[model samples]
Target: MAQNPERRAALVDAAIDVLAREGARGLTFRAVDTQAGVPTGTASNYFANREDLLDQAGRRVYTRLAPDPASVAHALETPPSRELVRHFMHDIVRRVTADRTGYLALLELRLEATRRPDLRRTLTARLQPEYEESIRFHLAAGLPGDRSTVSVLYFAMLGLIVEHLTVPEVIAADPIEALIDAIVDRVVPRE
Candidate 1:
């Protein structure tokens, strides 16, 4: 029989809470069960395995990082010029500060991907959209429009994520601050 909806959500929420509360190593069925107020058996029934559980957590993470309608509206209404990209960076900084757990787990997943090839596949799927969207935004701004350029931006964002997750300094590089400045300086508008 399928688990109750409330019960199922409880479990998923619990998984996120557990990851956030206890770090990746502390997330387990037993812990999630207790946190969710479900039986251990119930957790097993729902998830069936650890990877399945982590995948769920990853999806939750993806949703949090995703741009919302309001954010999207802002992006469209205001061009993703250097200044607008600075606002996007502020949002990223706020998220990293507000939800330390998600940021840490995100980096942890990246680190784990080095050893687990399958995890790399999973993360890449979630990452591609962000990459495409960001690259397309810059492309619209008359930035470089090429496959390799997009790949560089994608990996550069990943690198920045890791750096901030580990260091999380009070003052950090402004996202797109330098990148945008360089773009403005180098690329004269060609009409």
Candidate 2:
């Protein structure tokens, strides 16, 4: 409802932190305002309701977690190959790990979505296109994968990220990079 972009962005970002730290049940407008260090009701001013805040937080997490353009360009500069796929996978792990809060907030949003149909639809709409694009990019870039390969790799990496972030002890046996290499090797054929 507020027209100030900076304040709105700050509120959304604060909402993300609140979600990650307190889960959906604790994500109140007051919590976000306190997290943002703004006056009380500031978040409510920016967001029409809890649902609006949740939706914006979901979108903000993705925006925060998206790869930098420079990295994308660097990846594209290298010839498409299994090694490149490995590089991409490694980057994914690194980025998510580096932004643990964002990923955790995203996980929280995912759980909340189960109870909110509108959120489920919003997340599905946002994520499905990216999933499809991964497949398209793998094919168009001539990466060593088909749709199934990309799908499996996507799922495997997602599982690994969840484990690494939520219950790291489960994967403490091996270095994450080593595990990433194994996943890429198994899914993407050698050139």
Candidate 3:
């Protein structure tokens, strides 16, 4: 069945907004329907259950986590790839810092799913795509590691952000920036 592109995009945007605002706890069929300004039945028609919606939303958010290939290309279209790097860095910081609430919810989702191996399997199914995207992005910038490096970095970033949010004393000052810089230094060679 074909989908309406505009509506699909709106649903995705709504999913991000809902996730960012309320976390996984707040993601329900009716809630997303309201967020998208569509009818509850409409959401149901698109998603069979809460898990389906959340999982799909998770995928959407994961895909859009950073400066995508198109944006990277456009940013580098001019004289300086510096603009592209800056744009990418700016995007990364913004996305990571802005969606703490959602990230926490995702963490909770994982935790809850731990009791049900089937659910855990369903939720963790997202890890591969997320891992692949990071690996591809790092590789695009000439990083020398495989998917494992990207997975490790991705998990570490989330862990650091949570720690920084929950226990500032345990976290070093300028942690996010430091991590970003370290990642950049590895992925993008310094002049």
- State the C-alpha lDDT per candidate: 0.66, 0.93, 0.63
Ranked candidates, highest lDDT first: 2, 1, 3
Positional deviation of 173 in candidate 3, in angstroms?
4.8
- Reference-based lDDT, residue 175, model 3: 64
Q: Identify the candidate with maximal TM-score.
A: 2
Q: What is the lDDT of residue 190 in candidate 2?
A: 79
Least well predicted 10-residue stretch by lDDT in candidate 2: 1-10
Backbone clash pairs for candidate 3 read: none
lDDT (tens digit, per residue) of candidate 1 on 1-191: 76687777678777877876676678789999998886667788888687888887788776666656687566658644545544554566566656766767676566666767877899898777777877676667544335555465456545555566666463265544454344333432322
Please report how far candidate 1 places residue 157 from its true position, in Å: 5.0
- Candidate 2's C-alpha runs over 4 A off are none
Candidate 2 residue-wise lDDT, 1-191, digit = tens: 32899989989999999999999999999999999999998888788899999999999999999889898887899888999999989989989998899999999999999999999999999999989998998899888868999999999999999999999999899999999999998988777
Writing each residue's lDDT as its tens digit, candidate 3 over 88-112 gives: 5557657756765545555655665
Predicted structure with the largest lDDT when compared to the true one: 2
Pairs that collide in candidate 2 are: none
**Number of clashes recorded per candidate:** 0, 0, 0
**Cα deviation of 104, candidate 2, in Å:** 0.4
